[model samples]
Target: MTEQKQETKCITLKGSAVLLKEYLLYGINSILYQRGIYPPETFEPAEQFGLCILMSTDPKIKNFFDNVLGQIQEWLIQRIVEKVTLVILNVNTKEVLEKWDFKVDYETVSSNGNADDNGDGKFIEVGSKDTKTIQKEIREVIRQITGTVSFLPLLDCLCSFDILTYTKPECDIPKDWDETDPVFIANSQEVKLRSFSTSIHKMDTIVSYRNT
Candidate 1:
């Protein structure tokens, strides 16, 4: 008897957009917990992407992430966002200590749309990829995120994090969004981590820390 091959299906643009947003949210939360940016007790371990992941349970933190990821999803669908950066800084000195850069690539989207454009312009047909395969890739990225603690410097001082999105120059900025300069680390060491793609979108992860 021959084994039957499972058929793969292409996800819709809307579905891909949601998946990408969730990935970013979870990835940020994972980094926050792993880097000891917040109290470990504030997060609870939960199963996701075939791995036990820690997620923030505090109401204020949850709400903030919701608002940020909501707007990010909007930009993602329109394919205007180029990169999402998580900047960790020393609260006292207001100096950047570490940076987690998630570079985004819209594999099947057009480049002609403005940031204010709401309509889906020149839709690219998404190719088929197995859901399990995507999950496996995500699991690997998560493992890398967790392992980064071994190399990253100890954040002995008080620290805070800021989320920044790099978008097209023509993209309209919301009232809540303000222009800010990129927070770069001095004498930094960078490490490139594993990346995963959902056929329609690809995200590459990089971490830069202040070399002590």
Candidate 2:
């Protein structure tokens, strides 16, 4: 009998960015679906990161996230972004109801010089972490997002959502991206979710809702 060997899957800086982007995009969709932000029919289940994730299917919404996450991935590679937030607001009153924040820590990669932008303006691979571990962490985060409805107050009004990115003050802003103030909920209750690190980047998640 021949012995079987197991192969280790490694994560790179670029890979970490990709993973984080997917987490943001899919994670938001999961929240929206679980929280009734949109019609349940607007989303469909898709397997990702070894989990059955709900993905937005509306073309307009899908295109919007593509542009948003694409720019985020670029910034992630440059290590200039500090955090990304998802703000859900009441349509009529224009009041913030919920906020989902994903905080990024680049210190690990920065200390190793892996976050520096190459002359070619691309992320260079520096180190790797086991892919299975990363996915396990992501799965837990998604699970938490789905479970949030148990405690979050019912959103009684029509709601809309916006994406906000926090970056270095001196970072060049793209023409398509606009500057905005942070949207916060009043008398908010916050729940910290599971965090995942790819050795190059670490992401911490928190969800805040209006305590009404």
On TM-score, the candidate that comes out on top is 2
lDDT of 1 by residue, 18-134 (tens): 877877878889999998889999999888888888999989889988998899888877789899999999999999999999999877543223232245555444545666787
Which residues of candidate 1, in runs, are more than 4 Å off?
1-7, 109-124
lDDT of 2: 0.84
RMSD of each: 4.9, 4.0
Off by over 4 Å in 2: 1-9, 109-123
The residue-level lDDT of candidate 2 at 68 comes to: 92
What are the lDDT scores of the predictions, listed in order?
A: 0.83, 0.84
User: Model 1: clashing residue pairs?
Assistant: none
Query: Which numbered prediction scores highest in lDDT against the true structure?
Result: 2
**Candidate 2 structure quality by residue, lDDT tens digits, 8-73:** 433567778898998898899998898888999988999997889888899989999999999999
Give the least accurate 10-residue stretch of model 2, judged by summed lDDT.
1-10
